[model samples]
Target: MDRKKAAILALSLLTIISTDTVAPLVKQISASYPQVSSTMVKLTITLPSLLMIFFGLIAGQLVKVISKKAILAIGLVLYSIGGIAAGWSESFPGHLILRGLVGAGTGLISPIITSLIADYYQGKERADMVGYTFAISHFAAVITPPLAAYLGAEDWRKAFIIFSIVPLVFLFTMIFLPGTARRVQSDAAEKRKAPIPTKAIQFALIALVMMIIFFIVITDLPYLIETKTGISPIVSAFGLSTCTLGATIAGLTFSQIYVRLKKWAIPTSLLACGLGFLLITFSGTSVLILGGLLCIGMGIGILISLIMLVTANSAGEADSTAAVALVNGGFSIGIFISPFFYANLPRIELGLPAVEFNFLLAGVLFAAAGVIALLVAISTNKQLNLPHR
Candidate 1:
């Protein structure tokens, strides 16, 4: 890959990894924020993207006036700072604001990466990068929880400190990145901008909905394993790790999977995930729930990889940053809304330290998103009428 393309992939993966690294520290964070409710704590983790949804396009639109590399670097800086702040914060509101800053940085970096990658790579390479990015992100997801546990045990602050350093790694990547991919203020780019691909936007929306399912499985299901079934925190984290591990494997070959199956992959994976969720909801056995979670995790790996593939291809540009943004934006938005599903679940019983509902309603969302993904594919494929030859 070209330097610019490599930078885009590296930067995008960094943002993805950084966002989830805090998961293991949420409990520690809540302990310090004595006045913050659980909902607020959840927001501390989730609300940053609410800001991101509004401004994801701003950094890229400023491409003519600013360097894409600079914007990405700045975003990484914000992410690292916010992470550090979360670790150090004593007040609920302060952590909330810093997390938003972190989200903004994540929001800013992805579109530029999308735009740069589409601009620099093409066809299978572009698709492959999308999958690889997912794989790397999943790799982060796998490492972060265990790492966070170690760091948090040492000092919850260390978890955030660990992420503060991750962004610095990308600075070297920026140095190696080529700079030709900037929008360059050409009249041609301006004109072509008017007819943004509808299918790309469609894929983006699909990402948002599909990801509701992903989060439901990842974020919500573990609570169910812990509260509903009484699994220990350490065991729960390991079980959740199953999802990340699956994502890593699936993403490594996402382009090939996309070419072989296209949109069909989403529904197929969802079906598997849905079955797992159902099994967990009813079963008390740790082994059974773990197996179900494994299926859910592996299926989601395939599902999300497919979503990224569809978005990248639908845009039809090697440097289609907007396309990537659209999907990421959808993803961010889905994350923001996912907490509602957990509202109806069971609670930590009297004198018992635990969470309620096991995020069962969240599973309902996963099942629903799966159904919608299938419908979207069937309907849009017919509408687009892609080439028969």
Candidate 2:
């Protein structure tokens, strides 16, 4: 790959690596702080997401006034510092605070990466670059879990060390990433205030729902495997890796899939996810669970790339960063709320174990969503075929 693409791809890894890298350590971190509520412990995983929502939007505006590279560098510095410091924190509150810093940093970084891709590449090239972006990030996801599991095997603190790589990425950004001038808007254009495209908002909402469904695997699967199969947490972590493995494959193939599937792509991806969740619900063994996760991964992989492409294309250059940030922020919100949303559901009234029930619920929702998407796709196709008045 060329230097610019390589630098962007490396930056991609930083967006997701911190969360996935620390996921395996969640249970262990909870064990260390017995007085803390389970929800609080899980916040260690989700808190960054909460911060990302606000920071991402802030980043959208920042890019208008500052160079994208400068914004990225600042975020990297904060992310590296916060993520590494959180590992050594003795107090749970302090740890969460640091995690917030990490999230804020991520929020700042996330939109810039997508906006950069939208800025630099176009048409099929842009679509392919988006795919490659997700592919590289998911590829990192595939590697980090097992490594984090191993590193945190004896001490959960060690896993945070993964964040240290941010410094190298920062150096790469400075050395390789070309600087773009700040966006200069005319006074008339500024006063005119072009509205964000409605389609962008629609896609962002879709992204929100998709993320809620997708994160069920990430936030709940380890506990599911541990409780149902009595497997080592390492195995559970591996299950997480399998999801990303499938995602990586999907990312690598997204261009071909999009070309062929066209309007049907979203529905097909949703159905695949629904099927995967059903497999996880019924499967009795770890192998089956991993298989299910892989399927889920593939579905989400295509779905996310599709959303990014459509949302970017819907907006003008001036609105690109904010539009993309809206979708990414939706993702963070869904992820942040997932555990609480699933946990609060009346699983007891439904007469099912929590984890299994969460998976089953997600399966049913995705299946229903798939049906809806199919209908919408058919309607849209029919509309396009209608003669113009």
Tell me how many clashing residue pairs each candidate has.
Answer: 11, 0
Instruction: Provide the overall lDDT of each model, using Cα atoms, as 2-decimal numbers.
Output: 0.66, 0.83
Give the alpha carbon lDDT tens digit for every residue of 106-195 in model 1. 788767765665555566776677678778777777887777778788577777776655466567666888656643434656534644
- Which ten contiguous residues of candidate 2 have the minimum total lDDT? 380-389
The CA lDDT at 128 in model 1 is 73
User: What tens-digit string does per-residue lDDT give for candidate 2 at 101-125?
Assistant: 9999999998888888877777788
Looking at model 2, residue 328 earns an lDDT score of 87
Superposing every Cα of model 2 onto the true structure, what RMSD results?
3.3
TM for candidate 2 is: 0.93
Candidate topping lDDT: 2
- Measured against the true structure, the TM-scores of the candidates, in listed sequence, are 0.84, 0.93
Error of 2 at 133 (Å): 0.5
